[model samples]
Target: MTQPHLLYVAWGYPPCRGGGVYRALATANEFARSGWRVTVLTAGRDTFEQYTGTDPSLESQIDPSIDVVRVPFEWPAQDADIRTYSWLRAHLPQVWHRWRAALDTVTFPERGYGPWRAPLERAARRIQETDPVDLVLATANPYVTFAAADALFEEGVPYVLDYRDAWTLDVFSGVTLASHRSRVGRWEDRLIARAREIWFVNAPIRDWHADRYRVHADRMHVVANGWDPELLGGDEPGTETRGAAVSPMTVGDGDRSHPRFGYLGTMTRMVPLAALIDGWELAKRRGSLPPHATLSLAGYLGYFAVPDPEMLATIERGRAIGVSYDGPVPKQDVGDYYSRVDVLVLALGAGRYVTSGKVFEYLATGKPIVSVHDARSAATSVLDGHPLWTATESIDASAIAAALGRGWQLSQTADATQRDAARAYADRFRRDRQLAPRLRVLRDVATTPSESRG
Candidate 1:
């Protein structure tokens, strides 16, 4: 059979260093592995390398056979890289530029992504004229990717929208999205109605979108994030050598006494850092934790730049509560970091629809997980059956303290059989396994003549 042709639209791709890029790369590669000829349309390398911290290592995850097209992008006022700035911008006051950039985000639903609409629309039209595409898969954040897909749709090209996060609903605030009366809101509503299929990262998000767009529910699907085989399958300790620890006495060889609790991913305002600090303080006050228990956080703060004063204050407060900020850990070193942790802290914002991608990766580590989000969150649904997870009802310090104690207890006595079960549970969330069925559905949609033309 001739492989299906797909034009994938994403603002961040390999080398962009954003969290969503991992899923985009995995999705494109998996589709290619399943007999699809994929062409990825993304922002140019200059934007990725200079704006977002570039990681060439991520490219290794991309299938060399996949065709990727890089188009130029310029986010108004967000050019932190000195090289990208003109003489005027370079000389202009920093405060002035910052204000201009902030204004752009409010002007459109997607911060920094709105201005790229024209260029992206042109790119889509050019791609279609040069080579007819069987389908278009647009992953959103800037949500401007939807505009590009809409261009394709106008030209009778079928497209699917991958909503890594909802465009309309405020996931963190747990509020209804802007209604159709607003300009951007109307844009999203119309685009969604015309999409061939819509994929959300979790069920709650899928349900939310379904409830809003009831007639389009048949086209909506859920494709949760999962573990990458390359990142998960390896020696138990993975890449980290025993000598890498800061102190020898702090940890032991295959011993749980010196437990390291790690939190991996971005440290943003959305996270309940205040509650986390309180919980950490309670853990310290209990005096029951092992003397060597250390909570190490590994990730960036404040988008791509260093955190602001408020974020720094939160970090300082965490230090007061025995939580250490170790800065960002690259994706390549994630497995090594996981190996060092006896327990993982899944601290996140509360909402019925919000499920951060970290939960999937954390589950794959086979360590006891202490969830510091809402018990009713979508993440709980994924971790519910996993024996190693201890979820709390709220981010209250007392609740978190109790959960932390239980997690520590579990870590102290969890046998090899228990660890094996945890690992087995993670096995079910592999990237390929999570994405295969979704690809099949897209394939079916592409072949179905009635729905082939959006």
Candidate 2:
């Protein structure tokens, strides 16, 4: 049988270094692996470096069979070159940015990426014309990519909406981010109604969307993020399985002798970093933590490649305490950092639907996990079974301090049997395991006569 063509519309692809890029890469590669010719449509390389930073290591993991098309994207906010800016932009940055933002929403309700709808739609049409596309998988953040999928749908191509985050619902606050009658809501309703499959990263998000859009409830699929098989040495020469046994200490301050509490991934505004710092201070004052112990944060301070002054100041304040900010590590080196830590801190904002992609990686480590996020966060469910996981019911400084203290104690006392059990719990969540069946189902649905193209 001939292979079906899959056009994946992801704004953030490999080397983009955005939080959801890994999932996008894995999904595209998985389609290719499943005997589908996958083509990824994303922004140019310069956009990632100027805005979100680039990780070349991620590119090495992308399957050679898949073709990636880099579409031009102009993000005025991240363009730092003053010489390239127009006279008005250079003279009045605020006014220029406001105008640019307004211009972005002309094609769609989304900000920063609404204008991309035109180019993305054109790209999709061009690609489909080149080789007829059977299925379209469009991921969101810049939900405007849905426009391209919608375009294809209008012309009779089936599409799936891969939502790494919510659209009309605010994951952080568990509130309606957009009104049901708002422009965004209308767009979402239209998009959902036409989508063959709509995937969310977690149950809460999937449930929220399903409940709101009752017409499309049966189409919703909860595809949770899993640890990258590449990072876990899935195909490496020495390693045989996703959760192969490793030396107790891997790299990066492993020999520090003191208990190390670590947090990995991008340090965004959504992270309760300041509260974590304050809690660490409280732990120190209360003598709950050892003198030599350190709270190490291994990631970028802001969402973008550029440094954020406010975030830097927060890091500096934490430095005064026992907190140390180690800059971002490459995707391949994640395990090394994970293995080095005695205990991992899953510090996140108070959101019932919020679950960071880092949480799965943290679980795979089998190290003691100290949860500093809200008790209601979706991550709590993911970590519920881990033996050495310590969670605080509240985000208060005192509660966080107590949790850290307990995490340190767990790190010191957790037996090898307990650690092995934690690793076993995480083994089921390997990227391939999570994606293979989904891809198979997608393939079946795409080929089914009843689910024919719109």
Candidate 3:
């Protein structure tokens, strides 16, 4: 039997450092593991290095059998170089921005990524002509990837939509972002209408979509984010698994009195940095936390290559209160940072629908976690039964301070069984395990005749 070919359209693939890239890389690799010939279409390396930063180590993790095609993806909006701007853009930045925004959406409803549709469409057509794709799976945020998949679908090639997060619904605000009459609304409606299956990161998002599009409800599924074992599965040679032997003290440091706290993953604007700083301060001064307890952040400052200035400033100010930013950690070195911290900090934006991808990795570490997001967040379900989990009643500093104090306590007091259970609870969320059922369905499609399949 001939091997089935899979075409994956993703804007944030390997080297584009962030949470989304892991999902895209893992998805494509999983298909290859299941005996499919996978080819990924993504933006060129320049897109990442120039705009969205990169962790080149992730490229090595891609399946060697897969063919990855990189195309030119331009982001005029993200270009921070002053020399590249026009006279009007330099003189009247606001007016120029509006003009560019309008022009961007003319081709596709998405603003920053709409222009990428053309390059992706061209690349998709070229790939089809070369290999005759059997199936297409697209992950979005540039959502433009779906347009390329939709183009193939128009030609009777079936595709799946993997929304790492919602597009039409503002997960942060619990508000509708666009209407059916709007361009973005129509584009999503068309894409979802044609997609063979639609995937979301969590149930709240899936439920929201199901409420809106009852017709597509059954077709929608929640494909929860799980940690990749290839990266954080276990300890490497000479190293011990974090939480394998619980140590209340920071690595190599004997001071058990001042436990170290850490937060990993991209530090997007969605992160509650301000509140976290205030909470950390309050926790140290008034709460049960040790006055000298230090919280170190290990990650990029923002989603883009040019980190957010305001966020950077805030992290700088936090230094006075024992909060320090250690900078971005490469994918391979994430474990090292995880091992150093006694407790993990999970400060997220206020959103019931928002679920952080790093939560899975945090659970896998078997370390105690402290969540500072809203109590109603979908993540509550994920962390509900976690043996060493500490959550805040609200996003208030008092609540966060109390939770932080408790988390530090858990880090010191959690027994080996509780530590083991923390990792064991995450066993069900292993990347391969999460993808297994979905892969089984896709396997049936791969076996179907190319002429009649969708």
Candidate 4:
């Protein structure tokens, strides 16, 4: 079959450190693997380093076949450097911020990213001028890329909207962020009205969008985030880390002393870090966990170049009780961090739509996972049947502490057969496994073509 060209428009591609980057990377690479001539349209290195923070190592992991085109982008809200600030911003900061917010909405409803529409459309048009783009897969939540894809659709090209996170719905609260009559809502409606497909990270999100856009509900699909085999190592059924992530708990009673537990991901303000620390302290106070048991954390303190002050303080609060914070794991070395830990912590914000990308990686490790988020999270559905996973009955510290104790017990008691079962569960979520069907359908689009709107 002739290789179909895929223009994957994403703002958070490699080096732009965030949870969504992994899925974007995996999706692009998987398309390349499936014989698509892939072109990744994204923001340049400066945008990440100056605003969102960069993971330089992840850039190296992009597929060699994929051609990445970086465009200049900026986020004024995230600019921390004072020298660049105007007199109004430096002195009348609130006034300047409010003015900036209002100004940003002129081009698009998104504050920091509204202006991105022009650049993305220009780039998409430039790319199309060179050769035909068979299908365009645009990801969110700088949903401006969807506008670019919509622009193409107007010119006869079909596009797919990939919502790594929602724009109109507050995934953390399950509330409508903007009413359908609002500009943001109208913009989303226009984008979804004419698309080949729409993809979401979890079922709740898909269902949420489906409820509103009932007319085009059949176009939506759940293309979930899963662990990248290139990083955490592939799931080989007989391998030690395959059946379940690890078998350290099965290493006998003596090895249980001071077991290593770890949480690896961006430590944002939304996550329940305080509750997690409280639970850890309570666990130690009640002799539920060993005094020397280490709870290590690895990743950024927040999404921006500057860390969240409260998040930093929360990490500090856990220091005295064997909690260690190792900032940012390079993409290549993630497996090493997973290997060093005995248990994985799946701490998240409380929401039915809040499903952490880290959960799939945690499950892939086959380690006993303790859910630190609310029991109501969509993640609970993902981990419900895992042989060695435990969850908080509620988000209370005491409940988290008890869940931790249960997790420790599960790790120690689950035998080889159970561990094998756990690994089998993890296998279902490998990044390729989740994306395979989508690629096949897109392949058909490439060869036979979808109805041309133009």
Colliding pairs, model 3? none
Q: Which parts of model 2 are misplaced by more than 4 Å?
A: 234-257, 449-454
Residues 300-323 of candidate 4 have per-residue lDDT tens digits of 888777777888888898999988
431 Cα displacement, candidate 2 (Å)? 2.3
TM-score of 4: 0.94
On residues 1-454, what C-alpha lDDT tens digit does candidate 2 reach at each position? 6688899999999888988888898888778877899999999998888788899898998889989998999887667777799988989988998998888789899778888888899999999898888889999888988899999887788899998779888888788989878999889888998998899988999999888988889999988898765675444312454345332334234443577889988878878888888889998889788877888888877888876778778878978677887888989888777777888999887888998898988887778889999888999898888898989868778998899999888877777798888877887776767777678888876676544444
Clashing pairs in 2: none
Taking the candidates one at a time, how many backbone clashes does each contain? 0, 0, 0, 4
Which TM-score value belongs to model 2?
0.94
Which pairs, if any, clash in model 1? Answer: none
What is model 2's C-alpha RMSD?
2.5
Residue range 120-149, candidate 3, lDDT tens digits: 898999999988988899998879899989
Better of 2 and 4 by TM-score: 4
Q: Give model 2's clash tally.
A: 0
Identify the superior model by TM-score, candidate 1 or candidate 4.
Answer: 4
- Alpha-carbon runs more than 4 Å astray in model 3: 233-254
Root-mean-square deviation (CA) per prediction: 5.5, 2.5, 3.2, 2.9
Flag the better candidate by lDDT, 1 or 2: 2
> Candidate 1 — worst ten consecutive residues by lDDT sum?
242-251
